[model samples]
Target chain A: MSKESIILLLFIMVLFIIGGCQTQELNESGVVAGLGIDLEEEELQVSMQMARPALPGQSSGSEPAFEVVSAKGRSLSEGLRKITLLFPRNPLVAQANLLVIGEELAKTDLALIADSILRNPSIRKNAVVVVAREVSPKDVLNTQVAMESLSATAIPRMLRNQERQMGIYQEVSLEEFLNKLARPGVDPTAPAVTLIDSINGKAIRLEGTAVFKGREMAGYLDSRESRGLRFLNPGRIQGGLINIPAPFEGPGRVGIEIIRSQTKVEAANTDGQIVMRITYIGEGNYYEQTGEADILRLENIPVLESICAEQIKSDMQACIKQAQKLKSDIFGWGNIVYSQHPAVWAELGPDWEEIFPGVKTEIKVEFELRRTYVTDQSLHYQ
Target chain B: MLGSCYDLHEINDAAIAQNFSLDLLENGQVAFLAQTTQPVPRSETGETQPSQNISVMGTGRTAAEAARGMFLHFSRLFLWIHANTLFIGENLARQDLTLISDFLMRNRNLRFQTCVYLVCGVSIQDIHKAMNERGFAITSARGITQQIETQAEELGYYTPLANIELLERMLTPGIEPALPQLTVIKEGDKDRIVLQGMGVIKNNRLIGKLNPEQSQGYYYLQSKKKQGGLISIAWSDSPNAMAVMHCTQFTSNTRPFIQEGKLNMKIDIKCELQYLETIGDDNIYVPANQQRLEYLAEEKIKQQVRSCIIQAQQLNSDILGWGLTTARYQPGWWEDMAAQWDQVFPVVGSQVEVECILCSDGLSRESFRFN
Candidate 1:
């Protein structure tokens, strides 16, 4: 062959080689959007939310958006492979963004599941992890959402929205969770999910923060406690509201909108006694008032500030107390001592748990009111 | 061999799915819901109208069986590559999530970026009925994702999580997962889906939920980025007097130490804000008034942070990941106490320091006083 022909032949051969790999056509592969894992009767139950594409020139009016397939086996791999028996197309999980863990499986041992997920090369490491509360993962994957076409995608969006608007829960990704697990002093937590009865019907909601001891779950933090946990973390707070009794002698209340906040904790070895000094500073705007008090005057502002400070001091104290009661170092006090006073930690390390409950604390709070929105005067009624 | 078209598949032959949902029936069977978009033809002007959405339901003893059942009602093979959302019905979410996580991690066709949501206060059937009644298009998977991407940071309402992240939290030792919750509200004759707060998961079970306020606290604790939101302060002297500030910038720093053999943490937060609106006749531009405003803002933030901390302690859930900080800074002490860290967390004391700066005043420096 001529030189050009030879080159052309090589190019054609390269094309064939590239296309020769075991590649399934779009129609031959079932794309998975979500996956659920459950353990029942010592068997692994796996469910997959598979996408169903709408083809052109076909009657797609009655077709659904996706389908769910499930199988049971002794192992996760076996269960997933068994899906082929029921699903005609090869199951593909590379696109899945949501993973649900059954309550039983999460309680038993997540090490095996973690191993399987980490070992898998095709799985994405950024998928959102959730624990099914009082429900099975299969059922979660099967539910429909009114706002979004798929609940799998909508769920994560909802989490993001909650994080931004409420600042009550943190979303943990696979990679971030693994990093925390591998760390020494930190315990892992995951968002809990459940179904609830609403006026429209049964809906999905994120309920609480799951507390973990080692690999197993220790307990959970209710909404209030969860917010307290966020407060302990210096920068976790975004925006929230604080309601305080009107800083005057009246049966009224004032609502403050948080704009910025910071917390500082110092551990001092004062005269052989461990004392934790917590200073919290915050900034916000005047939001609402429920009583007919002209507390907006410049003279009364200082009193309002002090009252708000008192409220904060009490809240931090309560959070600390709750952590003490749970016996879970969700606050990392032990870690704090170890880092700040290595010598002291060395002596008290073994007995840190016993020493923690007796630790003394001093709290100082300062608040600043930044701006008044819209108007500068209260409504004067006849 | 020459590249052949032996495995060629036409787009017209496949069913493109946009959303997937799972529900548990009272009969112990799993129900699957799928929402697919139909291909729309172009008009004579070469413009295509919106595609039609179709819904299909299937039920079976297992997830795989239910999926197979979907084929009975439909003729085309289901394609999941484009599907990006999954919904868990109340019954299913309350039961367990193991099956879902296991299936997702092992499957090759699934993407780890798909979002997960828990259905609360409503059933999948109810949602379907609501959609049918309104004749609304259910292709909102992209819309929800877009909303989260565009608004989450500014709104401070929810945190978005994907499949791999959820599994990692369950499998990881130190941190836990917090998933976003969803619920439907009936407005007039229409039903609207809204994001609630978040669910706290322990050992893969949903134990409780964080309200919107608590959820905001959670977000604030972990957020490092500059946030945009409104902070409103109420005047104690006047019931109807209020002031609102728009947060322009925020930063938080934490310091952990051992003082007097006690574990203590020091936190410093700084915020920059703009004066937006007020309900009372106060010239905040006056130096004294500005100082007062700053104090009020600081006090409000301090109180909010403190309240959040108290609430967390009550729940005994360390969504704060404070343990990680301790472990990193004080490895020696953490080693001995890691096993019983839970016992040490509650008593840990903290100090918070906050500073607020008012950067600007909207349009007019003086309040609009009526004669």
Candidate 2:
């Protein structure tokens, strides 16, 4: 063939190859916002929140934002495929933001669900993982959010917001959760979402943190305990408040806003016994004085600082006490020992679970009052 | 030059979305309301009329689905590229904002600069219904955006939050998001949409709110550019006596430092104000009174800033973005404390220093006193 004809042949071949590949238009595929996995009578029930874009030339605000279609099968992919039986569009899970696990399923085994989600090439690894508390995954997905269009999006945002504002729970992405589950020393944890009744109607709220042992959820941490867990984890909480009783003789309280904190977990071996020493250094401002005493004065700052330090130390102690009772080392104390004392971990690796419950922990907290905000004196009323 | 028009999208074939309002229905469905404007045909006299505004409502389990449900009622591709405003109902805002923010950020057509508002005390449907009944000339959402632009700087009651800014604050480690709030009030037979203070969002939910005064404190702390506002100071001895100062130029600098292994923030504020009015016999010509006036003004500002900080601490929400400042200036301290900044933020100490200069006393130097 001539040179020009050969080029023409190549162009035609490219078009043919492109035509041979499978393709779907915007209308042909359903855009998924979130997915819920549940177990019902030995079957895997999967729920998909599908986005329904407005039809061309259609007036706006006349249709629903999304439709929930669910199906049950023996496996995750099968259940997802079966969703097409009720919905016309093909299910697309790539853009999904949340993967909600039912309480029952999370308690049984998350390994199966984790494997399926990890194996799927379309699902993003950064999708948030949440456990439905006192509700099914489908119910969690069905909860409508006023601030956000999709519950899938709302759950993740809630997780992130809770992590920053409350410091009670941290959002666990699919990759992070799976990595912790598979890691040798540390276990995994996911935020727990529940439905609550409000003045308007039922609203979804992130209530606690779910602690997992291996692939199954061991228990949950309440808000205060969750804060304790967050305190131990480096870079998990950015801002939170601590309320302590008034240091002076008054029937009032003081609010201390944490400015910066550092946690140092050291594993020391002394005379054949392993001990974990957690040193927490915190700095805060004298935020509010709901008392009659003038605690903001420089003379009383040390007293106030010592009281705040005691409050934090007590919180850490309660968290450690609760963890021992639950027999779950969500704080990764084992991981610290493994890294700091490898020889010790080798001997206790097999029996770490039993040893974790009895392991001795010494927590020391030092809190300092940095400033008294804009005023050095409280308002004095006659 | 080598581009092909094979997939040409015609503007006439698409419906331009101007505004969106989201709410949660009683049946646990998302109510998505959108406003679009369409051009009217020319009259026989060859005079072109103004474009007509169309309101459409969609309901579904999620926001995207409700948007898609709009297609069942109308037949046109809803284009979001022109969408500029988002109104969130109080009921929905009290629940969570994750889904709405995700859809907005992930959607390719929607711009991140779109302004967001939290509707207080009324449903989005009520606002739309009231607007249509009153036959308002301008779009209420657009009117709100304009009002915020004009009044936010002068009044300092509330600050405008864009889609990207809200998302950044919500996602960033140390700070939380706060949006301008709107409420509809009935006046005579007409309903008016007014800008309230601000709705403080924490943990992706609306926990509390900041009144106009408190909101001004937030504005003072966060704003870096020159600001304009009026500050009123009361006489120390007399209850009724008051003096009003019109702020002409204002600037603040926040510096975070570690003093003796403790974090400390120093905020220095400098402003020039013109004395607008005085109720009592306070003379600006007198050096002692002028000095007293300056001192009182500083004290007033300090009180507002303090109250604003206290309010945030009480709500346990860091809307002031103090954590971001610490992280930016003290990277080493932040590296160790970033994870626990939330716990540290509410109690962080700061010193606020204000320098006020009375540049002018308007056209008069003293108050009018009858002899």
Docking tier of model 1: it is: incorrect
State how far residue B276 of model 2 sits from its true place (Å): 32
| Stretches > 4 Å off in candidate 2 | A1-4, A7-15, A18-20, A54-64, B1-371
Who wins the TM-score comparison? Answer: 2
Error of 2 at B230 (Å): 29
DockQ of each: 0.01, 0.02
True-contact fraction per candidate equals 0.00, 0.00
Q: Could you tell me which 10 consecutive residues in candidate 1 chain A have the lowest summed lDDT?
A: A373-382
Error of 2 at A184 (Å): 2.4
Cand 1, B chain, TM:
0.83
Interface RMSD of 1: 22.0
Using lDDT as the measure, the top candidate is 2
lDDT of 2 by residue, B259-307 (tens): 8777777888787887888887645445568888888888888778778
After superposition, the stretches of candidate 1 with alpha carbons farther than 4 Å from their true spots are: A2-15, A18-27, A54-64, A249-251, A264-279, A307-315, A333-364, B1-371
What DockQ class does candidate 2 belong to? incorrect
**What DockQ would you assign to candidate 2?**
0.02
